[model samples]
Target: MSRTTPATLALDRAGVAYELATYDYDPKAERVGLQAADALGAPPGEVLKTLMVKVDGRPACVVLASDREVSMKKLAAALGGKSAEMMKPADAERLTGYRVGGVSPFGQKRAVPTIVDAPAAALPQAYVNGGQRGLQVRLAPADLVRLAGAQVAPVT
Candidate 1:
């Protein structure tokens, strides 16, 4: 078994029950989330891709379905910012303390504002990166809200 990442540790500290899943990772895969969904045999909608964005130059995370695209305008509006842009990969890695393909919403190096798209919250459970590639954590949507202190909004 792989070592628990800060994300899993945070869940533990919060007393949240979660399931850890690991699979063979193809580093060359184009879309990280789709690869994980295929490897885990889970529906794309059940797996969310955590994206880091800069809203008004402040770093924040947006969690949306693996197959969906985040609307920058909607995101900016939801966060009450004037503009939204995807964070540079290098900046994202540096800020989150995780690689580009494995940035999870939990246990970031610093706690940045996070917005969970409404569609994701509608699901009973969702899979998110567990702070490393090929690792995923499945937990109730409510747990994500409580653990990450994420704002539930329609940012997708």
Candidate 2:
């Protein structure tokens, strides 16, 4: 088998069954979710993206549907932090060792606190970035949470 990325490797090591999908990447694209959905034939809502944010001066990860936006106030309150703000793309890449379009909850350089939108847990499976811009991993919601050591909350 070919060597997988850190994110996919972590999922495999954790015994999480996932399907890897690769697509042609377009850097100028605005809606990554729509692009992925169109390319992979998955629903926009079922494909998730990992976002990096700062909560009370600490870096954290928020997983939400690609079509939705993260409510900073709700996220901060859920995390018991005073405020939350989106991390800069460069900062996110530097911290996670993955580029902006390829951030994944698993296999980050640093183990940051992670919160997944409650609705994501209800999905049968979700497609998330596979630690690389051109790749994605589809896995069960339970497995994703287990692999990422994420907390379930209302992140959307």
| Candidate with the greatest TM-score versus the true structure | 1
User: What TM-score does structure 2 among the candidates reach?
Assistant: 0.95
The list of candidate 1 runs beyond 4 A from truth reads none
Which residue window of length 10 is worst by lDDT in model 1? Answer: 1-10
Worst window of 10 by summed lDDT in candidate 2 = 1-10
- Candidate 2 residue-wise lDDT, 1-156, digit = tens: 223788987888888888988887678889887788778888889999889999988999999888889999999998999899999999999999998888889899999999989998779999988999878988888887877888889877
lDDT values for all models? 0.90, 0.87
What's model 2's overall lDDT?
A: 0.87
Error of 1 at 107 (Å): 0.6
Residue runs of model 2 more than 4 Å from their true location after superposition: 1-3
